[model samples]
Target: MAVSFLNRERTIATPGYSRWLIPPAALCVHLCIGQAYAFSVFNLPMTKLIGISRSAPGDWKLTELGWIFSLAIFFLGVSAAVFGRWVEEGGPRRAMFTAALCWAGGFLVSAVGVYLHNLWIIYLGYGVLGGVGLGIGYISPVSTLIRWFPDRPGMATGMAIMGFGGGAFIASPLSVWLMGRFATPNHVGVAETFIVMGLVYLCFMMVGAAIVRVPPPGWAPAGYSTPVQPKPLVTTQNVFVYDALKTPQFWLIWWILCLNVTAGIGVLGQASAMSQEMFRGRITAVAASGLVGLFSLFNMLGRFLWSSTSDHIGRKNTYFVFFALGTFLYALVPYSGAIGSIGLFVLCYAIIFSMYGGGFATVPAYLRDMFGTRYVGAIHGLLLTAWSMAGIFGPVLVNYIREYNVTHGVAAAQAYNVTMFVMAGLLVIGFICNVFVGSVHERFHMRAVEAEDEVEAAPVFGGR
Candidate 1:
């Protein structure tokens, strides 16, 4: 009986329900799960768990700790692909609730792992369990928001996803303060911090699950009309989630997203180190840290601003701008360093980060354009495999290329020049993929009878 409240039938928005409330509900989940971006803050503290003041003999290496975030990201894509159809069928409330449990539980279990000094336990708890939570929470609100704001799907998705990019701002400082508050002579306070954060996140996420509601069937914003003549690339037909895999357009967009992300994510992870290395005496550790913060701000803002712009300029054109402008900016980075222009170097990366974020925000609307709204959430889930792959590919490319250059006696400042060109080359390939993202073939779309039967088999409550 208690579980029934989470059913899809119970979550349908009643007449006169305010759609404006939905974005905030999404923000609750996103802002919490987005803490994954700041998990690095814990890496150093976690290494000191045994020694308190410094590394002990048994302490986990930095390289081993790095796998925690990698594992989380990898599982995020895997779980999203595996469970996406269930999320679509189950409703946002159920998915959000389950994600909340897993997310908070991961923290609690990891706290125990820290207390026990078991790295593998931390990997299973935070990496696998928390990652599943991140995946579910991430997509739970996407299709709901799209349905509620069909007139401005890009902007709607951007509003929710922007929280993910912004979450680090809140989490980074909060984590630092929490550790400080809990610290003592023998304890670094990591376990205590995790406990507090977990409880806080659980409470916040529950609020989102409670408040979220899906639109009733056939509902549309007042006076908004479906276009009689759909724009180029915009489809009126729906593609089954699995069938979408068979479309050439799907793979093209997949490559487009993957390559774009690889370029930015590699650089993003290495931003501080790269800035300090490239500029040498001119860039301090403090200044480099500030640059990372700046990247976060721009990354967050671009998600909203560029995605909203896509509503006007179109998704394909938006990605075109990302690849075209992004490629030029990446190539410009080495020149910025060569001239020793800190301002230009920062500016180049700032713009690049914005488009990197823009790429994430714009793709959902793009999927809606080619595949239609039904199953877009599930399709989007499948598409996130690109992100998982890019996560591994990007960091490895930057780290390995830079190491190889330095080992070969390249100057620190000049070492990243080749890597920058390689990133630019990646963008060139992404641009070509974007160029070929035509509409899906008619045969892949669900027929009217099939769509009707499916809808009848799973009717939303208010439609009756």
Candidate 2:
């Protein structure tokens, strides 16, 4: 019965539907789920709940707690790939509502786990359940927005995705404030804080679910027209989601995204630690925190700025800049740190972070270009498995390389030099992959007859 309420079609784009409402609805979901990035804020307190700065008997270790986040991200990729078709068939309203339930309810369940001092339960609640929510919520509006604003696909996706980068910015300070409010000397307040946050996000996500609506069939923006002869790499032909994965273009883009994310997110995962370690006593903990915040700001900024710019310069060219310039920045980081130039170090990392986000924001548009809008959300969901892979790969690679260097008698300050160069090499590989990304084969494109058949198969209904 509850499923019927969620799955029922609303079809709210009557005669006067406005596209402007869509971005806000997307922002609400992305902003809520994006809090996953700020999971680190809880790591310190969770470890020290039973004892200050260390774990006592029965307390979770830092390594154990880290799995909570890892599990969530792993499941996010899984759910996205598994449920991509469901999201397309069920529509955004259903997907967003389900995402809201899983995300909010996961928090409440994790609160119970915290209260019971059960680590595994916490992992199940926050990592497994909440990660599914993150996956669905992340892609909920992507296809809808691309279809609605076909003229500006890059900008449309950028607006929603940028909120994801910004979510950590809001969640970090807000979580600290909430924890402080609920804390006592004896209680770390994690359980109560989780409950409060869960409820708050539930309300916020529902607002988006209520407000969002898809366009009526065949609808397009005013004055917009499909190009008679599509530009290079831009496709008017739709491809099925499964067929898209079989194409070389998809795998090439996958390599591009994986490498780009690996290079940038590796640094992001270590930003605060790297700053303090590399600069010796010159960079304080407070200053390192500020650097993290600055990274977030640039990450958010680049999503919109670079994606919007993609409309003018083309998606391929934008990625050229990402790989080429990003490679240079990654290689330059160790040098900037070696010279003890804090400003140069920060500037280099900031640019790298922005391009990291730009890679995310631009790829949806890129997919739209290569695969067409019909199955873009599903293809995009499949492509995001790269992100899931990179999440583990980047941090582990950085950590392992640094540890190896330290064990070999290298000073802590210079330990990351090899890792930085290696990451730059990864980006160089990504640059080569991008060079091979061209138009999909014409044989793979959806036939006009097939599109008409699909349209005929869909049930007709009146706008609500």
Candidate 3:
């Protein structure tokens, strides 16, 4: 009975159900999970817990502590892929509630781990458990908003995803403030700070869970009509989630995402160092930090601004801009650094960062465009594995390229030139992939048998 209650569908929209409420609920969850990006803020303080820049007895070293974040991200991709189908069966409420518990509990448990100085326990709490929360929380509201705003999937998903980018900005400062508030002479207050954040996040996530509601089946806003125009990019047919992988379009899109992310994330990983190297010590540490912050703002803004722009221009065209314009910007970066143009360098990187974020926000809508809405959430979840892979590939590639250059007697300013050109080459590849992407084949789309099967298996509406 409890399981049934938890998995119940909210198929009926209540009177005066406001779509505006949905974005806030999504923001709440996203803003919380997005804290993952800001986890680095803890790295420095955590290293100094026992002694300044040194580990005393029972203290966790930086290398050991790094696994906590890695595990979380790994599990996030794993759980999302493994449990994504279940999210389709279970309503957003169930998935969201579960995510809230895992996310908040992960924090609370990590607090205990910190207090006891148990490194493995911290990994279990924050990495394994929190990662599960992140995977679920990330996609929880995505499909619902797409349904509610079918005409504006780009804008809808963009709003929520923008929060994920902005989340790091908020949590970075907030975590510092909280740590200071709870610090003792001998302790860095890591444990107490974790506990407080966990509780606060729990409260915030619950509010979203409570407020979120699914639209009624077949519901559309008054006067909104489904677009029936035959466009090459837009699909009227539905595709099942598993079958989506069988299509060439999916793989091509996947390739597009991977390459774009690899290039952007590589640069982002090197942002602070890259700025200092390019400017030849003219850029202060404070200025470099500010540059990083500016990158974050551009990333967040691009998610909303560029993705929303896709609603007017087609998704393919939008990506064209991303890859084409991005290729040019990347190629220009080396020249900008060579000439020592700080303003031009910053502007170019900022725009490229925005395109990076826009890619993330626009993909869901792109999937919906090609594969249809039947199982877009699941498909999106499957696609996020690419993110996990790119996360590792990006930093490693950048670091290796830079290291190779430095070892070969290259100057610091010129060290990243080859890397920039390589990144531009990647964008060029992505542009080709984007250009070749077509609609899913009809054979892979939901046939009569699958549609009938779905109807038979679907839950009863308005059930208590």
Instruction: Identify the candidate with maximal TM-score.
Output: 1
Worst 10 residues of 3 by lDDT: 455-464
Best by lDDT: 1
Q: Summarize candidate 3's per-residue lDDT along 79-177 as a digit string, tens digits.
A: 888777777656677788899999999999999988887888889999989999999988888888898898899999999999989889889999999
Give the lDDT of residue 289 in candidate 2: 90
lDDT scores of the candidates, listed in order: 0.92, 0.88, 0.87
Q: Which sections of candidate 2 miss by over 4 Å?
A: 1-5, 52-54, 456-464
For candidate 1, write residues 35-89 as lDDT tens digits.
Answer: 9999999999988988889999999889999989998999899888887878877
- Write model 2 residue lDDT over 83-122, tens digit each, in one string: 8877766678788899999999889999999988899888
Residue pairs with colliding backbones in model 2 are none
Off by over 4 Å in 1: 459-464
> Candidate 2: worst 10 consecutive residues by lDDT?
455-464
